[model samples]
Target: MNFYTVLEYIGMFLVFVGALFLFLGALGIFRLPDVYNRLQAGTKATTLGAFGAIIGIGLMRPEWLPKAILIAVFILMTNPISSHALARASYRRGIKLWDRSVVDRYGPYLREKEEKEGKR
Candidate 1:
């Protein structure tokens, strides 16, 4: 019936959704066939989940908004970059993809780079 009450409800909903995403991410990590797929699921889902949870907390506590926003921004920036780096390292170290993977755009590029470096 009031603005603060509405915000509290919304915040609770977001926190719940965020928790769900986190649970799904964990499940995906365990269920996926390969490291790449697991990384993808963990990174993307957890990033959104953390964002949602942090923003919900911020909404529920206005005084904590700035810190929450900072943390959210940090997670947003780092999660994907770290995941990509890990994937690339795994690929470079000869990690195999899942059997059902369709395409590999990085293969040719890495090969070419390796060749160029070898020639140098």
Candidate 2:
């Protein structure tokens, strides 16, 4: 097959994979036990899914590649930041984690900061 045709096939495959990730992300949001876990699902998976779809679109329409890549980069940069902000807000607001959650690195950090400030 020609180069463009091969690219089209790859684009189609990416789109399919992106859609699957999107579906799984949605399912995880609903099925996950806590807000943090849901946010994890929503941000990480959806970000990847969106990136895949955008890149796939770029592949299929070569002229649109630059814009698609720009959008993908924007998403990549923002998604995790937004998710972190949301999680931090939730934590500060005293939202409890799932009973089985194993780690809480943030709590200690926050407490240390507070102690330092109080001592000042």
Candidate 3:
């Protein structure tokens, strides 16, 4: 096959792979007990999934490569930070954690803050 045809196949493969990740992320959102867990799944999975599709599109369409790359990079950089902020805000607002949560590393920090504020 031609080079462009090969690239098209690869791009299609990536799109399918990305779709799988999106599905998994959606499942996690539905199955996870807490907002944090849901956010974790949504942010990471969706980022990678979307990135995959973007890269695939870039590969398939050279003219669109620059814009796709820019978008992918932006998503990679911002997704985690947004998820973290959301989780922290939920925790601060006293949102209950998952029953399956084995540890809470942030609990100590939250407690310390509460103590300093005389709310503990």
User: Which candidate wins on lDDT?
Assistant: 2
TM-score of every prediction relative to native: 0.92, 0.90, 0.89
> On residues 1-120, what C-alpha lDDT tens digit does candidate 1 reach at each position?
888888888989988999999998999999999999999899989999999999899888878989999999999999999998999899999998888999988889989998999999
Pairs in clash, predicted candidate 2: none
Better of 1 and 2 by TM-score: 1
Q: lDDT of each model, Cα atoms only? A: 0.91, 0.94, 0.89
Q: Clashes in each model (backbone N, CA, C under 3 Å)?
A: 0, 0, 0
Clashing pairs in 3: none
Return the top candidate by TM-score. Answer: 1
Error of 3 at 91 (Å): 0.3
lDDT value for candidate 3? 0.89
Better of 1 and 3 by TM-score: 1
Cα deviation of 46, candidate 3, in Å? 0.7
CA RMSD, predictions in order = 1.3, 1.5, 2.2
* lDDT, candidate 2, 24-97, per-residue tens: 89999999999999998999899999999999999999999999999999999999999999998999999999
Ranking by TM-score: 1, 2, 3
Model 3, TM vs. native: 0.89
> Candidate 2 local accuracy as lDDT?
0.94
